[model samples]
Target chain A: MNFVGRQAFRGPGLTFCRLLVARYSSKTGSKEYIDGLVKGKPVVVFMKGTPDQPRCGFSNAVVQILRFHGVENFDSVNVLEDEDVRQGIKEYTEWPTIPQIFMNGEFLGGCDIMMDMHKNGELIEELKKAGIRSALLEKAENKD
Target chain B: MGVPKEELEKKLRSELDPAHLEVDDQSDGCGAKYQVLIVSQKFDGVKPTIKRHRMVHGAIEEEMKSIHAIQLKTMTPEEWEKLKPS
Candidate 1:
């Protein structure tokens, strides 16, 4: 039984290891993943659908909020892009939801958490941490 | 919009292999809330913020969209007993 228990764990451990290796071996390697990701870039969102076509309200809300911030330097990836990365990211980031926000390579929590932080001014603080400062240019333009 | 509890329970147990599990259907009430209590070995080295919740969601990825808010109280059995020592 103990051996079975240990083997049960070893299975996933081995699986995770093989995934890591395969993740980096092909021409479509970690760099491609990184390139596809906005890790070192500005504000990047990995979402269910797209900013214009969010599959869920949660994704839409976050995208709308970012738009409100007048932060135009945003990039987005459709998590539905690759099924493996979509599922693997669930394991990789340990976040269950789409519309994951990353700022300069830092994980910035999920939609609800981000909404709370953005409501409380911490979103701007996090953005500052990533050297982002929102001028609300869109707000200004809309006003005019 | 709500899934049958028995089906959900069976699927969750089979998929996530939890050490503990609980489910409440509060869809008729405010927030469309469902309270889930689950403890899984998969969460042993995972972060507390969402480890158990995600495990459950992954197990029932299809249901999350329909169920509005799920109040999750995920813990190892050791922690579950401590928290619910009533």
Candidate 2:
């Protein structure tokens, strides 16, 4: 009661409320937590929804593009589930969008970059570098 | 409410001084969605694709709050020339 009132008087009540929300939502939104989550993953997508059921078209496109390369096992974090994560990821990568990709724990840009890489054959080359054989490669070999 | 296309164009023009620039309002006249193609010397030494995107995002950071999505194609003038059907 007094604590809430004091915090409200100190700043905008909205910031206090948001801080409370973040405090109660576990520490998953922390930069260190996200850093640990991506450190060892070969491919990770911080997107709008789960890999199996992406909510946004851009996120869906990311999932589908990875699927096109036969990358089904990559990790995915649905930003829609947690507001903190949704905001944290944007700040972490300094990219202002959903559907952010990280390859070998490195920020790989957003869906547009993925689309460009897919079209330019860079996605396959990148997957190879990450040690994940793209299904397209197998299909091309079969055609030979 | 959403931002006007001309406002975004003006912002990009002043910030990037792009040699070639295209801004398409993908959300009809509503202005919530946009696709931008920018070819500027500002991107000449920026190698990473994400870094290029960050520069554009930085310029229009304010507009982004109201806009839902932006499909950006950012490149140096030389890179854009190679992409042209010549």
Q: Against the true two-chain complex, what DockQ does each candidate achieve? A: 0.13, 0.67
Best by DockQ: 2
Error of 2 at A54 (Å): 1.5
Q: Can you tell me which runs of candidate 2 are displaced by over 4 Å?
A: A1-25
| True-structure lDDT of candidate 2 | 0.86
Which regions in candidate 1 have their CA more than 4 angstroms from the true location? A1-36, A136-144, B1-86
iRMS, all models: 3.8, 0.9
lDDT by residue (tens digit), candidate 1, A62-140: 8988876766557665667456656655555666556678888766766765676677677777777777775553355
Candidate maximizing lDDT: 2
How does each model score on TM-score?
A: 0.52, 0.84
Deviation (Å) of B22 in candidate 2: 1.0
Per-residue alpha-carbon lDDT of candidate 2 for residues A1-144, written as tens digits (9 for 90 to 100): 685567578766554765465447586677876786587678989988788788999999999999999998887777887887888888898888888999888888899999989998999988887889999999999999
lDDT of 2 at B52: 86
